[model samples]
Target: MSERLNGIEAFVAAVEAGNFALAAQRLGLTRSAVGKSVARLEARLGTRLFHRTTRSQSLTEDGQAYYERCRRALAELDAADAALEAGRLTPSGRLRITMPEVLGRVLVAPLLLELGAQYPELSFDAAFNDRRVDLVEEGLDLAIRSGPLDDSTALAARPMGHQWMGMFASPAYLAARGRPASLEALLAQASAHRFVGYVRDSGRPPWQFRDAKGQAVAFTPSSQFDFGCNSLEIAAMAAMQGAGIARLPVWLVREALDQGRLVRVFEEPQAFGYAVHAVWPHARAMPLKTRVLIDLLVERLVPALAVR
Candidate 1:
C-alpha cells in the first residue's frame, strides 16, 4: 500500500540519519507524521523497527534486519534511477561489506574510499569484526575473510591469496634470553621463556605446530608461558614488551620488523598460514556495485597485503 511504502521510506531514512526528526526533515514531513508512519509500519509488520528514547533512537534486532533489506531495496531503486538519468553510468549503489578488524582497517577501508571517489553515486556500509557473520542472514553483499570457509549451499567463496604467519620477539627479550638458531635450540630455550598464544574455542590454548621432519621444530611454542588471547594484535604487543614470543601474520608485524622492534624467529617453511577469500551469497546475483567493489579489492588489496 502507499502507506507501507511511505513507512518503509521513513523508517529507512531514520536509520540512516540516526533520528526520527532528521528523517522527517529529509522527507519534508512533520516529525509526528514520520513517527506515525513508522509506527504503522511496525504494526503492520508485527515487529518494532527501532527503540526510541528521549536521548536516542536505536534499531532493535528485528529493526536492524528490516533496515538492511530496506536499505538494499532503496539502493537498488536509486541505482536504477541514476542509470536512467546517466546513460552508461558506471556502477553506482550502496555496497554492504564485512571483514575481519585488522584486514578491514589496514587493507579494505582504503580501497573502498578510493572506489567511492571514483564512483560519485556509490555509497557503502562496512562492518569490521573478527567474529564470523552469516552474510545472507544479515543481508551483507560481500565479506572478506581469512582461513578455510565451511561449505555452504547458499554461499560462494573466491580465493584471493595466502597469509603467512611468523614468530617474532622484541630485541630486549632477545638480548636477555638470546635467540635460537634452529628449532631444537628454540624449543630448548623456549621452556624457560614466557609465550603469548592463541585462545581456542574450548577456552584452552591453540595447538602448537611442528615441521614434517618432527625436529621439535619452529612451530611449537615453549611450555614456559601459557598466556593466551584471541587477538593477534594483543599477542604481538605482548611480544613487543617482552611478554613472550608471538606467532602472527607477516603483514601485521612488517612495520615492527622494519623498526627493529620485533625479529622473525623462523625463516624457512613459514609456519601457520591461512588463505584469504572474498565470500558472498550464491542465491543472489551480485549487484553491479558489489561486483565492482569486489574487483577493486582484488586489484588493489591482494598485492598490497599478500605475503611475498
Candidate 2:
C-alpha cells in the first residue's frame, strides 16, 4: 500500500511537472528514482503511462484516464484534510476587539495584518476606543486595556506585557535646554523646562519616575505651557513640538526614540509601569475563533511590546 502511494505521488508529480527531471526536483528524489517509480506503477497496472521520447514526454491513452482519476482523488483527500481542520478549529466569523487608538496603531495593527494572512477565513472588527465601553452590552469579543484590570469582575483577563513610562523630550528641546547628565540634574533644571501634562480631570499628572536607589518619586509638572489631556498620542506630539517633557509609554515613543526625534531623559529604571490587559466576557465556553486570536495576541504582543 505504501509503495502504491509512493508510485502514485511520483506519477502525479511527473504529469504535473511535465518531465521526470522536474518531477524528481518536486518529489525530492533522483530523476532515475522517479522514472523507476513510474515504471513500477505501469507494470502493476499492465499499461504504459507515458510515451518515451528524447525531445518530449506525453501521456498515453491509459495514462490520461489514470491521471484524471488520480488528480480527483488527491483533491478529495485535500478537501478531507481541510474539513477536519475546520471542524477542529474554524478561525472564521467576526472577531470584534476594542483597544486604545495609540496601541492599535503602534502594536496591534501590524499583528492584526499577520493574523489575517494566517487565517484566510477570519475577519476583524477593530474599534480604537479611548473610553471604556460595556463589552457585553456592546457585543465585543475582546478588549485590550492599559493599567490594572481592577475593573475586571465578569471578564477573563490576561496581561499582554509590562509597559514602562519614561520621561521623553524632543531633540530640539533637549538640544536648546541641554540634556540632563543625571536624574538629579534633570529635576534641578526645572526652571529651564516645561511639561506636557496628562490630565484626567483628577488633576495634572505627576511626572513619575524611579530614583537610582529604586524609590518611587512623583512630582507634578508646575510649568505647563501647553495642552493637558488624557491622550498619550496628543501629549507625545506636544513633546515632539518642543512644548515640554512628558512621561510617555515606551511603545508609543519607540519610533521617535529610534529616529532620535525623542530621547529618554533618565537612565534610571522608570518607576511607573502599566500592563496591557486582554479581557473577554466570562461565559460557559469561549469560542474557538476567539481563543485562537487571544492566544495569538498574547504570544506576539509580549515580545513586541518590550521596551528595548
Candidate 3:
C-alpha cells in the first residue's frame, strides 16, 4: 500500500507546478529526484503520465484523470486528520508567533499570557518586530498585523480590531504654545511648532487626518526636533517631554492621557486608522493551538482597543 503511494505526491506536484524542476523546489527535492519519482510512478501504472520534451512537459489524458482522483484522495486524508484534531479536548503544542512590536507588547501580550496560564500543555515562542513577515518561510504559526494588507491566497486573516491615531501634546507645551483651533490652524502654525515624528526606513510617513467631508488627508510636518526614529514609543516619550505635538496610536498613550502627562490636542481620532489582524498560513486543518489563539484575540483584543 505504501509502495502504491510512493511517487503520487511528486507526480501531482509536477502537474500543478507545470514542470519537474518547479515541483522539485516545491517538494524540497532535487530536480533529478522528482523526475525519477515520476518515472517510477509511470512504471507502476504501466502508463505514461506526461509528454516530456527538452523544454517542457504536458499531462497525458490518463494523467489528468488520475490526478483528479489523487487530489480527492489527499483531501479526504486531510479531512480525516482534521476530524481527529477537532476531537481533542486540550490544546498542546508550542505556538510560534510574530507581531508588531508596540501592539504586541501593550495589547496582545496579556491575552497570550492568560492563554498560557490556562493551558499547561501550551507554550509560546513570540517575536516582535515592525516588519512584515512570511509565515511559511519563517516557520511561524501566526502573526498580528496592523494597517492595510496585500492581497494573498497563501494565508488567512482575521480582523482583531481597529487602532485609532490621535494627536497629542504635553500640557506644558500646550500652555506655552497654545493649541491650534482647527486642522487649518495646525497646518498654518507648523513652522512655529516642533513635531515629534515617527520615521521608517523608507522615510517618514505623513500624519493622517479627516476633513469635514470625512475624506482622508495627509500632512507632513517639518520638525527640527524630529528624532528620525521608527519606534512609536520613542515618539510618545518625546511628546510627553514637551518636545512637540505627536500623532500616535491612542492605545499606546492611554496611561499618559489618564495620568495627565499628555493631553489630546484633537477632539477626534483620525478618519481611518490601522485595522489590526491575526494572520496565519492557510491550512485544511488548522492546528488547535493557532485556532484557539485567534479566537482569543477576536474575543478580547477588540474591546481593549476600543478603550479611550
lDDT (C-alpha) at residue 53 in model 1: 81
RMSD of 2: 18.2
lDDT of 2 by residue, 1-308 (tens): 65676678789889999999998666546687778889989999999999988989999999999999998877786677566666765588788998988787778878777888888888999988567888888999988888756432245566688777888899898888888776687778877777786776555657666776778787765755366877788999999889888888887888899998899876665356777878787542467678887788878888777764
Q: At residue 89, what lDDT does model 2 achieve?
A: 58
Can you tell me which runs of candidate 3 are displaced by over 4 Å?
1-78, 223-225
- State the weakest 10-residue window (summed lDDT) of model 3: 149-158
For each candidate in turn, the TM-score is 0.64, 0.64, 0.73
* Segments of candidate 2 deviating more than 4 angstroms: 1-88, 181-184, 200-203, 212-215, 223-230, 269-271
Displacement of residue 117 (Cα, Å) in model 1 is 1.9
**Which residue ranges in model 1 land beyond 4 Å of their true spot?**
1-88, 200-228, 283-285
Query: Which tens-of-lDDT digit does each residue in 1-308 have in candidate 3?
Result: 53355478778889999998897667545577678878988998999999988988998999999999988887787789878987889888899999999899987889889999999999999998889988888899999999976554345577777788888999999999989876788888877778898888878878887787788888888743455478899999999999889989888999999999999886753355788888887554678999889888878888877754
- Candidate achieving higher lDDT, 2 or 3: 3
Best by lDDT: 3
What value does the lDDT take at residue 9 in candidate 3? 72
Model 1: colliding residue pairs? none
Q: Which one wins by lDDT: 1 or 2?
A: 2
